[model samples]
Target: MFTPSYHDGVIQHLITDVSEDDFNVAVGGQVEIIGWLYQYYNTEPKDRAFKKKKYLESDIPAVTQLFTPDWIVKYMVENSLGRYWIDVLQAKEDPRSSREIAEDFGWQYFMPEAEQSDQISVQTNADSLSQADIEDVTLIDAAMGSGHILIYAFEVFMQIYEREGYSRRDAAKLIVQKNIYGLDIDTRAFQLAYFSLMMKARGANRRFLTLDIRPNVFDVPESGELTSADFQELLQSEDEAKQLDYLLDQFRYGNEYGSLIQLDKSVDWSMITRISNQELDEGQLSLSSIVLTESQDKLREICAVGKILSRQFTIGAMNPPYMGSGKMDSILGKYVKKHFPNSKSDLFAVFMERLRSLTDTNGYYAMITQHAWMFLSSFEKLRSVLKADTLINMAHLGTRAFEEIGGEVVQSTTFVFKHQTIANYIGTYERLVNFDSQQKKEQAYLAAVKNTDVDYLYRTNQANFAKIPGMPIAYWASANLIHDFEVGTRMDELVDAKVGLQTGDNSKFLRIWYEVDNKKISFRSVNLSESVKSQKKWFPCNKGGAYRKWFGNYDYVINWKNDGHEIKNFNWPNGKQRSVVRNPSYYFREAITWSDITSGSFSLRYREPGSIHDHKGMSAFSKDHELLIMILAILNTPVGDHIFKILNPTVSLEVGNFKSFPVIKNKTIEDKSFNISRKLVQYCKEDWNTFETSWDFTSHPLLTHIADDNLSHCRSPVG
Candidate 1:
């Protein structure tokens, strides 16, 4: 009897001694490992029963590496393979009969088997097909891991066959041999495939095995039996080497590199006792050697068979391995560049090429792969090539195909491409096709637009309009209004006179005062005396009135003190001492407001009302100041608003670091907001001999018209 132990919620085998009965029980599924507890105990059964009991008492980790849950497998199988099975069954029945049956069942009828096979073959070949014809079909997964897809395909085929009058037994064998094929780099996976197929075949007649295993299964035939050599000899001399090379290459790479190397590295070579000479003689090669060579040779033969099959069946589907482009090192990158030059040529690209090579004209191929190929700039050229050559039908799968298998985070997309067709059916063809195509040229004509005016002359066009086609439009801007204004005049050139003054860290130098004794205040050019009766109410202040001091005798001519020690100073227009009165207590009732007139002050002061200096005696000529004020007012008019809105759509008056500007808005030339003020300043600085006469404010028709229009519009809305 076989006994098992449980540890950490896993079942393990307990018996140290092994026998043929135990092996048979495990392989035959007589004693199954039903859950996590079963697997742990079954794998580690040799310890004392109590020790095993203690381990089993421990809690299981939240996650464990286990086979995929059956329900998920069922869902994926039904959605993908289920639909495929129906197509195959419909193809086998009479066309009319199938159509009638499909109408009743609400399913699509499949084509005749011969036609279906021929179409699949044609679709795999790239030369004779266009992008449209093969878009609907795809190849099945060729190298599915764990036989997940294969098993699912089998189940689907079985359902279809049952509906078509075949018993589960017959259908099982047929589906294994014809509908599904699988390959894996692991020996264990290969073993699983064989076992799984055997389980499916259980209900069939024993004779069914002979037929199911005949075509591809290789075993030493009777002494005079024919071999691969016989088949090679039958082909034309010209084709023989090519076929042999293909076979040899497959053998060298497919199984040798894929499975043998893996096994040798994993298993220990040193092991036990030999049987009798006869028994040894019967074995010929060691189990390892036989397995290594046979598996390798089998893969080569499979590739050769695939080439032959391509001539017979065209449509192909696969969920190829997903690896990021970053993983492609120099060697693989160079190889892809050399051989698959016309193709996109990544890992997925190689699969696509292989599938295409196997198909005939009008064949179809489908795959679920990484979605990065769609919009990535690196793949843009590749997308262009595909757009020109194949019709692609695509749907994005938002996440990794197998959620539970912790691998890379990948977004997937399903692509269906037809080998050859006359018309394109996919929606993305326009985007994928290169701009150099005729279609793009036509679209360009429709989207081209032209605009010209005095202030601005330019053309506008959409970059991708050719792929989409439409008529071009025209836009016009007003002629140069600024043509009359001098362009290069600097600020000094525009003003008759200018002055500069330093405020000397204005925040520390400026005086701030607030009134507490009177409801009203006044300013005058006079000095206050300590002897005044109201002297107690006045305070020499600092920093927005937070600090104060009593006056005293200190620089008495330009500065004075109300008390015995504190000093107070007065500000003069030009930093020069020129005063008249030492005391005017009544007139010193309020604080004086000072101003700084550095460069651009007059222009800024003219535009902003509260920016003027009250005590500065030097003033602009009456005519010049009026002109400056008028220009400033004109800038705020509706006409100016309209012109700026059209020319500088993206500009905001708020000041900060400038970024995120629209590309188009940066191109316009007439966006300067202070142009009018600068022009008025230029008019003011003219020496009658070198410059034109400054026009009287009454003679400027454009400014007057704008002012009049604004007034009329403003009053029009008044009640």
Candidate 2:
């Protein structure tokens, strides 16, 4: 049972190098240090998985491990578990705002409901809740990685027990037994969570650890060889034996999907819950061999997970893993695609749905997840089911909110979700994105809560989201801007916009115009027939370039000889067509174009009559050239910038980003935009022509001003 190597290396390292400093905290005593340590410990594996460009099923936990910040955990729990108790208190005629009650009860992060007059028809979700007695109240962190949320929740449970006049000792045990439940995919995390919880209990009561207490926390196990036949001897009843299949089925991908696994509703776990903890009889214990005992242990553990999963909790506080569908392993990708279609874009959105379902309809669930779900078109279906009024409050914590994650990619929003008392609920939203660092954002949030006019704070009816094009949670969008969609015509209707074609191998069929013979490029060909007649191998292609308006970025030329014979037929080793030749007929058409993506600002430029648009060089075509110019002018204005910001604020501006762009029609060029656009196009073209790279370059503007005879006066008009 003893290994000298373990004692010498592991024991010696800890005894010499580790001490109380590793575990001790200055405030929030007995804090979940395990979560932080786990993150650090997992650095090597996380880096390894990321370096590989793909994740194995076993690496899912390491790859997606996010040690939720302490403040975020508190916010999630306060708004969810804390709000549930406050709702009951308010319903019982406490006559205090939720924030007031929460602060008095030691929950500072809880935001109060907006004050509404009695004239409003909306009702609070409190009326729908079954007021489970204090002991019956339950909370679960389904994806409780290192149990940070659960540890904070423990303190809240202790507070509730004290208010109800229970002894600290009794409350500690009961809290572990009935109040909090957790599940994680990683066993290392589960072990750390277990030790942390035990230490927490021991801190409350010295004798707590001495008792044979097992908190309702379990690491989802790999269902290796978990056949029904294996449990045949362990389970006495025929029905109980058959029920093993359901439990086993739920854990088929346990290594890949932890608490995200939904238990089967068909299985009745009442008897399983009762007999799951049965002690061995004296006769059986003496007679049983190792195999029998192991089987019994496996059955009990499986039943415990099934029982916890099947129960609907009063509250859910979680910081689930974050991974996109593209990065997900095969098993998980297939599971989420079939099971969570609406949220299949990312794992966090999937958990948002899963956790809400695990909660009672009247209960609350709060989480900190990628803010993309709030506005991205991919998650519009997710927002549909969770109606506007379901929102309680949100802290839109955009990028740089994590200590380790320093980029603008991992943006986040933490919020509470529960049905409101009324139809049109006014929810508070704090836009803490402008600030950097976790501490600064937390400070800003506190400041916003204290004073509503903190610039970033806003109180608005969430029902207004439904009036928008795709139900974006644009809490900061002005009322007039939102209403404009009602009277506006979407860009799809006004202009014929397309994403354009893609050459699978840009290197093979593309060349900088000057890189090849000038005579081989068909710069003046207006149509495919004209280009073929010219006997040119290359034609100008409108590839995306720098942000500029009107007549520039005449970048590269594509090999369209014989109607793009090479690009059109480009195939992969798997016999799949690789080159995406979209809108072939629209090739060589005079259209307005723009870079598909930009840093912040947007601009549209004119495409010459003879060019094919690149995939990134998106184009909009119209038979009426004046209408096209008018739209181009409108797009270059501040109005187009505002629309892009409202619709999608991410770095990549997609083709579909403008499909919902509203355009108000005006004929006769009443705004004189048509003429201004024409003049600007000419001015830009002249400026462009003066540059050496331009195909129309005659001479530099500086050269036109000076002549051999007029060296003294230098009076050319261009001067």
Question: Which number leads on TM-score?
Answer: 2
lDDT of 2 by residue, 116-143 (tens): 6675523344464435477888999988
**How high is the CA lDDT of each candidate model?**
0.34, 0.80
Per-candidate TM-scores read 0.38, 0.90
RMSD to the hidden true structure, all candidates: 26.1, 4.6
User: lDDT by residue for model 1 over 99-152, one digit each (tens)?
Assistant: 344344332211111112343333232332232221223334443434544554
Summed over model 2, clashes come to 4
TM-score for candidate 2, residues paired by index: 0.90
User: What does the lDDT come to for candidate 2?
Assistant: 0.80
